[model samples]
Target chain A: MKSTEILNSLQVSLTIKRLCHQLIENHHNFSKSVLIGLQPNGIFLANRLKSNLEISIQDEVQTGSLDITFFRDDFRRKEKPLIPSVTNIDFSIENKKVILVDDVFFTGRTVRSALDAIMTFGRPLSVEFLTLIERRFVQNIPIKADYIGKSIDTIKEEKVSVLWKETNGKDQILLYSPT
Target chain B: MKELSTSHLLGIKDLTKNDIQIIFSTADSFKEVINRPIKKVPTLRDVTIANLFFENSTRTKLSFELAQKRLSADIINFSASSSSLNKGETLVDTANNILSMKVDMLIMRHPHSGAASFLANKTKTVIINAGDGTHEHPTQALLDTFSIREKLGSIKEKKVVLIGDIKHSRVALSNIFALQKLGAEVMVCGPTTLIPKYMSELGVKISHNIEKALKWCDVANMLRIQLERQQIQYFPSLREYTHQFQLNKTLLDKVDKPITILHPGPINRGVEITSEIADSEHSIILNQVENGVAVRMAIIYLLAGSINRV
Candidate 1:
């Protein structure tokens, strides 16, 4: 296999700081908006963003984790059962602006499933997507990120991976292709 | 990334300690989901599950169905009385017909021991044993232990007693395996005939006297007397059984420390336990029922995760 690093730790950190500033420009108070990290992969990114955003605004931001394991369209297609991650949304989402965060944006299916999963809590006044890396091509669903750290163009065979300091002990984005 | 060694939940004996921990932790997450304003999740949206109850069930059937629905799986209910089983259709044929309709998973409660395991070998669909005859009610054991862990904070080193009919209870057998596996001390308390002769071989302590069992236990799981399974007279009369074995507030009050009371219900209120004790603060019977849904969800979610893996 062949791999390429797109962003190192310093670049990733600077991108997150920029994202936090941009978030404050749009959501100054965040009184009506809540941040939801899609489960398993998105949780670390969501936590980092929540921490950064809170420090920048000097105000607490409500955050929770949502696992869409049951809501996926491909669940029946796979032979192995998908182990579910914990969903810890103690607060209601009714009429609130919801920020859905994830490490990478690919086919947009995950975001679509996250949308369906979030409605169960309550109807959101608006929904926004945030991603550390966005693959500009290969979206099966018509979805785009409102807050993107970096957008990269890639072929269908190439995979975009985001490694977080919380999980991988380093912050980096890599693109890989079969040799 | 660790998965259950077995594909189907046939019995408690098939589960290892690690399997139970994974299940309990998964159930813990689901327990949180059910308490939310919107109790439903969408993880099983594309999966279809059929609840096939060859035995009559209120709690097991309803709880399993609720768990399936909350996971967003399409559900179909098949009770033996309402189906072609009454018309003499074989279990295999009935199950095959359901699978023919593209059912992904089967949650079964059957009257014969090992029925779920037997059917599991014959089908490609994942099978979960809700309960099986006088053999093993794996889910009941799971929910019971789950409820116990929720109330007491853990199942390790807890003193638990299974009281009433032990010979004919699938619940007792499964609980013995589960509780013991989780590091709890288990004891069987009942009459000689009702308590099996070979139960001692299963590493369970035996107590014939109800009062002694109650005093020794931190949790007393009062099982319903299976009158239907008794072909011959095990005891002289219901009066005699109640007089000797019935758990009431008076008996419970006499214990030095408060002991938790559990009963797998369709409870014969005045027989195994009085209404006062069943309704008391010491009872976790209803909590057991509530936890049943969460535990079943966890099991289904886990099993479904690996159903069609490449």
Candidate 2:
């Protein structure tokens, strides 16, 4: 296996800051909008974005984590059972702008499932998605990221991994492929 | 990432501690889902489940049905009284007939022990035993233990006493298996005639005294006196049994330390426990019912996941 570094520690911090600024530009005070991080992989980036946004706007940012495990189309199709993460959106999302965040945007299945999962909380005004790493040309669904940190042209055999300082002891994004 | 070791939820005895923890954590997730503004998930929308109850039940039936609905699974309920069982159709025939309709899973409650096990061998669909004679009600035990862990923080090292008719109570047997597996000490306290002789052999202590039993434990689980299952008189009379074993406020007050109380209902209002005790802050009976849906959801969600094995 070959590993290629896509973004380094400095690049990750800058990209997150850039994403936060873009989010602030659109959502303004964020009172009418809530940032929801997809569970497991997306929560790390979500938490970082929340803290950064709060520091910039000098106000509380409503953020929650949503698990799409149960909502996934492959729920019972995998070789092993899909274990779910906690869905902790305590506040209702009724008619509020929802910015769904995740680490890597892959087959668009996660976003599709998230769309279904988020509806159970309540009907949102408009839902937009944000991702740090968007791999282009392989999306099986029509879903696309509204705010992207980086977009890379990739193939099916190669994998993009986003490592977090919060969980992985370092911040970086790496692309893996067979040599 | 974690699948149940077995595809079917037959009994607590067949589940490992990891399986129990998995179910508890999954139930915790479902617990949050059910409390949300819209109490539903689209997880099982593609799956279909048939609840086959060969015995009469109120709480278990409703709880299982509610859990199934919350998961958005297509559901069909079968009643023994209304079914072709009157013509002496075998349990397998009845199950196969239902499975023919492309039912993905089967949740059943039969009056005979090992009925789920028997059907599991005969069919390929996932099976969950709601209750099987005096054998085991796995989901009830899961919800009961879940409620205890919810109220007490943990089940480890907790002293839980099962009080009342142990011989005819499937909940008691499943509770003993589940509690002991999770590192909780269990004791059965009731009339000796109603308490089975096997209770002592199972490493569960037996006590004839309710006050001493209550005082000796951290949680007291009151089992309803099952009159329907009792063919012969297990004790002299209901009045005598109540006078001897019914738990009221006075009995609770004498215990010194407050012990959490659980009763798997259709609680006999005054026969096994008083209405005060049933409705008191010390009681988590309603929580047991509420958790039943979550736990059953976890059980069904875990078992119903993955159709290739079927």
Candidate 3:
């Protein structure tokens, strides 16, 4: 499939709307919950979720961003690594539930590192993962997302891409197979 | 590949080759930002940076403050004399209070060694060592290295002679580590009492006289004679020290090879170096001051972003 056509079929905005409804229904009892977005694209999605959730819940939600460049497990191979984005969660997460949001879930390494990076700040009551896309047969770790938009069966050599209107000038997901 | 997050920058010896390269490359980015029409960048906007200086400093403090402001970070200046510490509050208490204020980073200069490291352990905010009592000044060392690279093309195999008051100057100690790490041949020359005899243990050469040390050296770094050194009896008189250790026109004329002169300001002109030599063509003291802001901007930028992923 062409990149543009695959992206158009992804329906990220619709997936986000459905996920917000489900998250509110599941987490309604928690009063002091916060949402943390992984750096780059995850932060973009988290901000949208915060705005959408505010309309449904009638209360403000605290949002934070995390950069996992330094915390990555594989760091020896890259040349001139880019700086990570800002991580700004002002509230104490000690007893509050944290819903970690990201755009795509691949081998689960990013989410794994995010968990380790967040613990350095404070201990959250609990952390639940949410992602727009989940691929099949790629479980480097046993951890799974609590909220997944869609799970696609794919080969190991395929690449999954998420593009949003805020950053990439459109909302779409592209699956690229190695040549 | 990924960049390593160093917990603190306490000394040059603590940095690895990768760490030094990261610092230099980051400083290069800041150098580009400084040359633009609008010098400010939004990278550090809304980030609060605190400059806690327990020691008297004019130039270093000003350069740090300007660096933060140019990056659009909010700045809070706290001096020892007018601070709550003067009202009998402990250094830890003062630092805790500032950390309580939700400052993003703390750049400190104290009269005691390990003051910045102490603050780093007590708080979560990133701590930058501005200057600590005769211990190390990492940022100054970075700017000096940056200046040397800009002038000489490469620091590897270059000869650097650090002259005068080695024991009392933290800058000298920091330079010794920095130059050696960058592959420069470092030598310290001064009076026997002022120069630590065992500095050679750190892989540096020691010379009592400037004339022997200056031969074929690519750079001469003159350290200021701290006026307090006289009261402490490191030397008997300023006139005698100047006559013996000063870098003047006559000494510069005798050197067979062209050499760069460096001094961390504000200069004690006519004491360690003459006015004629300080303002001459070979002086990089002013370049060192100008690059001070860029080097510090790189440090604050990298450290602030190091916690998160882009």
How well does each candidate superpose onto the true structure, as a TM-score?
A: 0.91, 0.98, 0.66
Kindly indicate the candidate among 1 and 3 with the higher TM-score.
Answer: 1
Tens digit of lDDT per residue, candidate 1, span A64-158?
99988666777646655556788988788999999999988989999999998888788899999999889897899999899999999998899
Query: What would the TM-score be for candidate 1 when compared with the true structure?
Result: 0.91
Candidate 2, residue B265: CA error in Å? Answer: 0.3
Q: Is candidate 1 or candidate 3 better by DockQ?
A: 1
Docking class of 2: medium
Query: Considering only N, C-alpha and C atoms within 3 Å, which residue pairs clash in candidate 2?
Result: A76-B306, A83-B1
State residue B84's C-alpha deviation in candidate 1, in Å.
4.1
Looking at every candidate separately, what fraction of the true A–B Cα contacts under 8 Å does it contain? 0.61, 0.85, 0.07
- Model 1 has an lDDT value of 0.90
Q: Could you give the candidate ranking by DockQ, starting with the highest? A: 2, 1, 3
Sorted by TM-score (best first), the order is 2, 1, 3
Please give, for residues B176-231, the per-residue lDDT of candidate 2 as tens digits. Answer: 99999999999999998988777888999899999999989999999998889888
